[model samples]
Target: MQPQLLTVPAQSGPTEAVPAVRPVRFAGLRLVHAALRRDLARLPNALRLLQPGDEPGAEALRRHWDFLTAMLTCHHEQEDRRLWPLLRRFAPELRLLVNWLEDDHHNLDHSFTRTTTLMRIATRDPASAWSVAYAVEDLAARLETHLRIEEEQVLPVMTSLFAPQSRVGTLGELLDLLRLADGPGAPDALAWLLEGVAPEQIEALIAECDDLTARQWPHWQAVYARCSAELWGPAATVE
Candidate 1:
C-alpha cells in the first residue's frame, strides 16, 4: 500500500479554515516517516538475498544504508532540536511521552551501530549476510514500536497545532521549526518519497508544490526511477 504523503488527521478541526493543504505543510514529515518505515522493514530481507556473495547487490544495499541513516539522523536531530522543543513550550502535558521517545532514539543506537557494522562486513563476506539480516530485523522491530507510538501519540498533537485557533505555531512555522527544507541529497530525498506511490497520487502531490518544484517534478521522477532500479533491480523501475 502507498503511504498518503500528506495527512489530515481523521478530523481537521480548524485547519479546514484554510483554502488548501500544501504538501510541505505536513507531507514532508510524513514522507520521511514513511520512507524510514519502508526501508527498516525491507533491509532484513534484502540482506538475506545477498548471502551468496552478491557484491554488486551488497554495494547497492550499502549505499541505501547510508541514505537510511542520513534520513534517520536528520529526522531525529530536527525532532530533538526543534519539534520536541516546540511541544515542550506549547504542549507541556506531552512532556513525558516526548521524553520517552527522545530516550528511545538514543537507546536504539547500540543496535544501530551493530547493524551498521554488520552491513559493512556483509559487503565483503557472504557469510556475514545473516548477521546483517538479524541485526536489521532487530533494529526494525525496535523502530516499528517507536514509530507506532509517535504516530499514535505525537502526530495528533502536531495536527492540533495546525488548527486555526492555535496561537503557538502555524503550519509554516512548524514546518520551519522542523527544518524540512532541502540540504544535501534534497532532490533524491524528495524523490525517495515518491517511489512506489501511485502515479495519480504523485501528480496530486506535485500539484501542491511551488512553481519551481512543480517544474522539477520530471527530473525527480527520473532520479527516483534510477535509484529504485539500482536498489531493487530492473523489476523496480517505474517503466
Candidate 2:
C-alpha cells in the first residue's frame, strides 16, 4: 500500500472520530516517506555494484549510508519524542498500536546500527559489501512495513490530535525547533527529504522551514546530486 505523495489530503479512515489525514504537514511526511521508499528500494543494487577491494567505492558508499542513517535517526527521534508521547497521552486506547510503532523505531535503530557496522567493515574489506547489501535489504523490507502501518493506522489519530484548533504547536514550529536543535545532518536531511519533490513543492516546503534551508537549498541539492550519482551510478535517477 503505497502512500501517494501529494498535497491533497486523503482519508486514512478514522481511528475514532478524527479529522481526515489531509494536511500540509502530513504531505511533508508522505514526501519524506516516499523518498525513503524509492531510494532504499534501489539501495541494494547500488550496494551490489561495489567491487571487491574497491576501497574508494566502499568508502563512498559508507559515507552515503552514514548520511542516510543520520537523517533517519533524526526523523525517528522526532516521532518518538514528540508524536508518540502525544498519542499515548490522548489516545490511551491505541496504546498497543502506539507501542508497536515506537518499538518499530527502536528495532529499526538497532537494524540501522547493524548496517552501520557492516558498512564500516565493508569500507575496510569491500568483499563484505555483499553482507551490507543484504542487511540494507532487510531493513528496507521492515521499513516498508513500518511506513505502511504509520499511514494506515496512525495517520487518522495524528490528524485528529493535531487538529487546527488544537493549542499544540504546528508541524512548522516543530521543524523550526529541529533546525535550531543542532540536529545532525540538517542540510543533508533537507536535501534527502526534498529528493524527487517538485521544484515548486521544494520551495513551499522550504518556506515553511527555515531561512538556512532556503538559503542553502541549491547547494544542498548540488552536493546530494553529485554524491548520489557517484554512488548509485547512471542507472539511478539523480533527482
Candidate 3:
C-alpha cells in the first residue's frame, strides 16, 4: 500500500487523555514522495528499453538512473542530518521507529548500489538485462516498504513538530533544511519532484519560495521538461 503523504490529525479524545495530535502540512516531503513513486515505477521499463545493441537508449536510461540516485541520496541525507534529529527530540517515544527508518536507509543504499552495478553490466552485455531488471524490481520492493513506514511513522511526527503553533519552527525553515540539492542538475531534480503534483500543491510550494527562486522556477521547469522529452521520447507521459 502507498503511504498517505498528507499529515492526518489525531481525533478528539477524553478530558484526561492526551490531546489529539493535529496534522501539519508537509508539502515538500509529499512532493518528494510523489516523484519517487512515479520515477521509480518507470525504471524497469526504462531498463527493458536498453537491449544489447541500443547504445542511445542505454545512455539515456543511465542518465535518468543517475539523476534518480542523486535525488534519492540527497533526500535521505537531508533527513538523516536534519529531519530525524529534530523529530527524535520531540517524539522520543518513537525511538525504535526512528532506528528502523535509519536502518532502511542503509538497506536502500545497498539496493541502489547493486541495481546500479547490474545496470552498468547490462549496458555492455544485453544478456544481463534480466539481472538488471530483477535488481530494479528488488530495489522497488524494498523502497515500497520503507516509504510506507516512513510516511506512516516519520512524516506525521515531522508535521506535528513543524506545526506553526508548536513553536518548533516555520515550514519555510523546514523547507530550507530539507532542500535536496542546489548545484548542477538541481533544477531537473526539482522539476522531477514537481512532476504530477496538483496545481494547489504547486501553488503552496511556490508560495514558500524566495523571490529569486520564484522567478527562476519556471526556467527550471522548462529545462527539465525538455530533458524529460529527450529522455523518454514518444512516451506521451513520463510519469
Residue 226's C-alpha lDDT in candidate 3?
68
Clashing pairs in 3: none
Which of 1 and 3 is the better model by lDDT? 1
Best by TM-score: 1
State, as a TM-score between 0 and 1, how close model 1 is to the true structure. Answer: 0.80
Candidate lDDT (C-alpha), each: 0.69, 0.70, 0.66
- Residue 185 lDDT, candidate 3, scale 0-100: 54
Q: Write the per-residue lDDT of candidate 3 for residues 30-146, one digit (tens) a residue.
A: 556767777677777666766668887777777888778866776777677767787678789888888778888888888898788887888777777766877787777778888
**Model 2 root mean square deviation, Cα atoms:** 6.4
Shift of residue 182 alpha carbon in model 3, Å: 7.9
Ranking by lDDT: 2, 1, 3
TM-score of 2: 0.79
lDDT, model 1, position 230: 62
| lDDT tens per residue, model 2, 100-174 | 888888899888898788878767776666777788788899898998998888877777778654523343544
Error of 2 at 119 (Å): 2.0
Q: lDDT at 103 for candidate 2?
A: 88
